[model samples]
Target: MIGAFCGSFDPLTLGHVDIIERASRLVDTLYVFVAVNSEKRSMYSLDQRLAWLEAACAGLPNVRCAVQNGLVVDACRKAGARVLFRGIRNGQDCAYEQNMAFMNGYLDPDVETVCLFTKPEYDLYSSSNVRELVKYHQDVAKFVPACVLKTLLEQEEMDENIN
Candidate 1:
């Protein structure tokens, strides 16, 4: 089955990569969907996030990244995906994702949502938290892939200047 993972992925953290990798193995094809939330201010632009995602998942031939604005179920339909892949870190995340799954079901019952519990090591890391750490110049090499870290480092000066 074709599967889709949808998220902002502002900086494409390793935790996100882990989910993509595992999900890629479970389905014939995996689409990494990045929502273009116009109301949300992101550390990285949609293009940067998509590029980072592409770079991070370069090793996985079945994984593809796309940016779109609208309901995730619509994106899933466009990709011809039959499953929506999600990662849950805790009860809170589970509850949130469950609600989303329910809504997705309402949108299209043909697609199913599969939530994976986060690996303990990655449970505490998220794009927002990692972005906060980066803003303070804390080492984030451990939280993201080498390519993502490189982009962060390369754009560090620009970020500082903007701030």
Candidate 2:
């Protein structure tokens, strides 16, 4: 079965990678949809986000990365995915995902939403937190994937040089 996992992924975190790895195992093909919203300001560009996702999922042959311009259900429909994969880290995430799953179900009944609870080790990791840490010059090696870390470091170096 084909599954779709959608996220803004301004910077791909290890928590996201863990979900992707687990989700890929459950489905024949897992599409990592990078949902881009112009209204929301992101630390990374869409192309950078897509590249990080691709690099993070390089080991998973069944995982593919794609850009999502609109609703997640629409993206799933376009990709012909029957399952929508999501990761829940806490009660807040659970509540939010539950509502989204309900809405996605209403939007596309053919696609089923699957919420996977995040592992304890990665439960605290979030892209927003990681971005904040990076902005403050805090070490985020454990929170993000190597590819994302490398790029972030490079960007920081470039910024430092410019300043």
Candidate 3:
């Protein structure tokens, strides 16, 4: 069974990696779909996000990274994925993902959404929070994966150099 895990992933967090690793084990192939949302402003570019995702999944042979510009269900359809993976951190996430799952099922009955709970250690980590911490010159090494942290630090140095 092929699974699709879709997210903006402006900066891939450790929580996201955990879900991807777990999801990869359950399916023959897991597509890490990076969503492109034009309305939302991202700290990292699409290319950067893809790179981070690739790095995060480098060791997982069954995981592949790709970009999606439209509905996640459409991406799943294109990838021939029957399962959609979602990582839920709290009740808020669960509620929002449940609605999305319902709508996705409506759009494609063949695709099923699977919600995975994040580990307690990673439940508090979010891309937005990590970005904010970086903005304030705070340490975020624990929140994000090493590859992401390295790229973020490099980007910060570049920004400092430009200024």
Candidate 1, which segments miss by more than 4 Å at Cα?
157-163
Top candidate (TM-score) = 2
lDDT for 128 (candidate 2): 90
**Model 2 TM-score on a 0 to 1 scale:** 0.97
Of candidates 3 and 2, the better by TM-score: 2
Worst-scoring 10-residue span by lDDT in model 3:
36-45
List candidate 2 stretches off by more than 4 Å.
none
What are the models' TM-scores? 0.93, 0.97, 0.96
Output the worst ten-in-a-row residue range by lDDT, candidate 1: 36-45
Tens-digit lDDT track of model 3 for 52-154? 9998899999999999978999999999999999999999999999999999999999999999999999999998898889889888999999999898788
lDDT of each: 0.90, 0.93, 0.93
Candidate 3, residue 15: lDDT: 94
Q: Distance (Å) between predicted and true CA of 38, model 1?
A: 5.4
Residues 32-148, candidate 2: write the lDDT tens digits.
999986667988888999999999999999999999988988899999999999999999999999999999999989999999999999999999999889989999999999999
Residue 147 of model 1 has an lDDT of 87
